[model samples]
Target: MVAVTDKSILGCRYGSSQPQRDTVLYADLYREGRLLLDELVTETYPVEDFAKAADDAHHGRVARGVLVF
Candidate 1:
């Protein structure tokens, strides 16, 4: 399994700058990285949808997956 640190992931998500926030740069990086994953999946799940998936996974209510990047 690939272990991604929170700091690195957050940096990818929010960028390392203040103004402009480098959003586009980070987004490009994320797309490239995610493309290397086993699955070529992309979806925008709302909070409720995520929570339900987590519940099903564990048979209990739990916070859904949080992708800092």
Candidate 2:
């Protein structure tokens, strides 16, 4: 993987700069790096478990967690 540059950090990543506070962008699902995981997903949790997921994320136990109905 390549290191992110200042320009990339400003452009590709959002909400990092104070000047961008007023800029609004509408992104398409696919265009926003959204992907279809389908059955490839490994874990899921109920919405009530969000606190547990938040703790896991804070502790670096997982990269991400999903809450579902």
Candidate 3:
């Protein structure tokens, strides 16, 4: 299972939860999502760079790893 939550000052959404006990896999998925968002912003919102705005969302998950509960 996978879950995401948004609890930031500007309201960002990131993070993922899985039932599996694989830290590497979770990290890979999280990184992929971050890269995707980065690319999306670089291509679409070059001027505003809204993707950076969601850094906190991604950072929170990366810092804590995958949530198993």
Using TM-score as the measure, the top candidate is 2
Per candidate, the number of residue pairs that clash is 0, 0, 0
Off by over 4 Å in 2: 1-42
- Which residue runs of candidate 1 sit more than 4 Å off their true CA positions? 1-16, 19-21, 34-60, 65-69
lDDT of 3 by residue, 5-61 (tens): 775566434444444655677678778784343433322223354454346346652
Please provide, for model 2 over 1-69, each residue's C-alpha lDDT reduced to its tens digit, 9 standing for 90 to 100: 988676543354444544443333323443565644444444577999989878887887766577897
Model 1 worst lDDT run, 10 consecutive residues: 60-69
The TM-score of predicted model 1 comes to 0.27
The global C-alpha lDDT for each of the candidates, from Candidate 1 onward, is 0.52, 0.61, 0.45
Per-model TM-score on C-alpha atoms:
0.27, 0.40, 0.19
Worst 10 residues of 2 by lDDT: 21-30
Q: For candidate 2, list the clashing residue pairs, or say none.
A: none
| Model 2 error, position 42 (Å) | 5.8
